[model samples]
Target: MQWKQNLNHWLHHLPENDPLKIELENYQSDDKLMEDCFYKELEFGTGGMRGIMGPGTNRINLYTVRKAAYGLSQYIKDQGQEAMARGVAISYDTRHLSKEFALEVAKTVGAEGIQVYVFDKYRPTPLLSFAVRHLNTYAGVMITASHNPPEYNGLKMYGEDGAQLPPDAADVIIDYMNEVKTELLIEVAEVKQLEKDRLLTYIGKNEDIAYIHSLDSIKLNDSANNKDLSIVFTALHGTATETVQEAFLAFGFTKVKYVYEQCGPDPNFTTVKSPNPEEADAFTLAIQYGKGNNADIILATDPDADRLGVAVKDEKGEYVLLTGNQIGSIIIHYLLEQKLEAGTLPKNGVVMKTIVTTELARAITGTYGLETMDTLTGFKFIAEKIQEFEQTQDHTFLFGFEESYGFLIDGFVRDKDAVQAAVFIAEAAAYYKAQGKSLFDVLNDLFEEFGYYIEETHSITLEGKDGAEQIERIMESFWSNPPLHIGGIQVVEIEDYMTSIATELPSGMKSPIDLPKANVLKYKLEDDSWICIRPSGTEPKIKFYFGVKGKTAEIARNKLRKLKKLLLQGVHV
Candidate 1:
């Protein structure tokens, strides 16, 4: 069928009361808007389905959501009735229709004779992970787009292990979803009937309590009782405020302030241009609150509270946002040092980081005699490492982090938990404050010890179907015509992750990389600098990650700038 015809079919099939359909109807005369909305079905990648919220299969609506739930239900049933009986947990964030989507998933799964544990209100992504494990559910669903714009929404699935479903399982779920021909056939038990049958359970404070208790275990030094230290936290108008606040208080942080404008679960995220904490603008309100309160530290969590961003007063008393790498290094160093001092550091402990993350984490972990492993960019891979350790190795999992503001300190929750990170960061701040040093000062100390390693991430967004094709072409261009030099520095090695081959340039020796195959390429420079390129899994963007290490910060920054320009030139060609 033609794309337009298929789109029309989908639009007409939508329920009359569907808000998305109504919105589309209002734009019926606009050809461009219609084409954009119905160009393709929203791609469900490793992170699950995320797209604009509107009518049509290309958007995130009640129909697409139900189809995903039905597909998940089918997958669980195929795993056997026992797995289905184990059921699924459902949670939602502060996005539009999040609650409605959660209920729809519950009803759809309930119709398959599988139980559903649905949160009664908004919750963080990590809380959903915790709920999956706490309830011993077969699977979990979270309705959130993380830090995406308010126009966007998404659904993520978690395995019984409380991590996002691994690729192998995700493939099966996607296959089942594709098998769904029509949303009309997606079965859904009546909400009332599902409740009567006890298949749909509304979870509330109990799950929150369990999650918070798990967060308390993140505190490394209970004796760092500098309760007078002031701190400010902001949720960026998302779902994290209450849990983060409670966790801080429970951890004995006496002076915690919240940015009033961004504290609540506002779906619109009105105060910030974007809900993502990765951007400095997202922390503006928090900075204001922090400065007004004379706070020593400011922390912000993205919409779903899976990633954390931090700002600390610099030497000049100006609040500066720390890169994700800086924060990860600080936390890893702090946790290891404190644990070792207390004689509680695990002897066979392991720390995991993404391949694109800062090597500073590896440096710190090695100094502490802990093994550091690198995985693909997503936190699921880190979670996979934790499960691997649990099943086979004696390695006690200590910490895991990615360069993209995601960190998982303890394995209690498989994914990153900003709630847990907030507690530990607060404790670390207090500990440092007791020594008359700020986080910024401690970061410099880390650099002094571990060498100056600087990392930067640049993303080029190419929207729509054509942009996706261009991204593929750019990646292929790199693979076919590999660069011999970057920023006039000799290329030492080239790692083609898709082919699992690491080729040493000078010797022409190739070795296999013992990691999952991903569409990523890394170029190692002679000066120990490197650049990596990978298309974003969830967004319409191609990202370049640059890491440069030098004797001084200035040298590293200069090398990084040159390397970035070279990389951009390569991508453009």
Candidate 2:
């Protein structure tokens, strides 16, 4: 393969004292490892770039990071002097090399005569979003892999609006990244020089204080005493422990307990196989603490604290982990009900969710007479809608969520916030507790009122360059050979997002989809169940999302399992 040639070239040219050189020497005997490391450059997408940490063009290292930073700097320069002066707000989570990468981006920007504001140390991803708006920076960058494994790390760039870079802006950065031949040869400003020139600033506590105060606005029951609620929270060995604890206490939640074992900044994530809350095992320790302390709820955030996972006591006192959809459903009901009663619900109020999220959100928000809008599957689209609301004044963005546990309760923080969700959900539990109802009970009540709606996501992981190609073929297969039926249900309608059209099966009727075009295909069944297929934007997986509403939970589970099995047939990615 040409990858060997690339490896030999790097080995010959890379400096002897370079840190990545040692990593190359260790793997020199392994051709497969060398191919994977040197085959191709990591592409920065709408969510920015992420990869395994090592030496090579394919890996996330100082050289590749420098290239990304150089592109970002040039992009800022292209935006004009005002944008360069406004600068970029930078932050990192507790992942390894997070601090170094944050500084790397900072120095690159500063070297180009652009200002840079960075956190003193590790902070959650949401705080970075808040900082971008708080500091009035031209853009923002966060160093994290979110919930990826310990060996992986990433860089996510955000625009001035505090959302992930939209398509138009991201294209500009990619264009600049393409022109750089040698990523490691980039220049960076010295830390001392930047500081002396006032081009680099350290953002410490004051911005955090502003964020904490904003969380106060999310409390539905501001006057409701939180004494009755007990919370067990774990940061999963990443960021969010201190900020969450402080915010909880400040909001009058005094009985909060922490899972001490998982609180430290251990980059290996020794406690769990994967530190992702979407998996049941992530909440193992937190649930144990919840049971021991008789806590009302258990909360777990990913490495960056943008995504939240929840576990609540069921009727039999079993700690049942709630899906992202379920938690979002509960939060929506609680927040909107309070806002409605207080006569605070805006006349033009709206709730937003990704197209892949459960329609249960639609039912709940519709009951409140709030308009519901669907964006392509990302929190950035929701944030875009929030920004649009501010300019047009046509609709007030009341709430936004994705089925992946990313939620933005208000526009105060433009990105998904687990710190905000943690405290707010605790308050929600307290509100329900005052009525002698558990969150599970509230969920059951919603099911009874709106029928039992169950949503499940099935993902097929494919890795490296070949896997990316296979994922594309799988998407192409779904597009060309559309299924007639799934799990005994007829495909009544198909929405091909890539084509931006909805087609009715029998009548052959068609209508345009208004949202941004994406590589997603959704089929609505005759029985009201639905299935969506899309390649995950952040990870190397083809995700199939299923949602079914049945008269009973058992029926929904059976239907979901059957459909998942059918979809898995002949698909090996």
TM-score of each: 0.97, 0.98
Instruction: Summarize candidate 1's per-residue lDDT along 228-328 as a digit string, tens digits.
Output: 77989898888998898778777888788888888887899899999988999998888888889999999999999999999999989999999989988
RMSD to truth, every model = 1.4, 1.2
Clashing pairs in 1: none
- Candidate with the greatest lDDT versus the true structure: 2
Off by over 4 Å in 2: none
Relative to the true structure, how large is the alpha-carbon lDDT of every model?
A: 0.88, 0.90
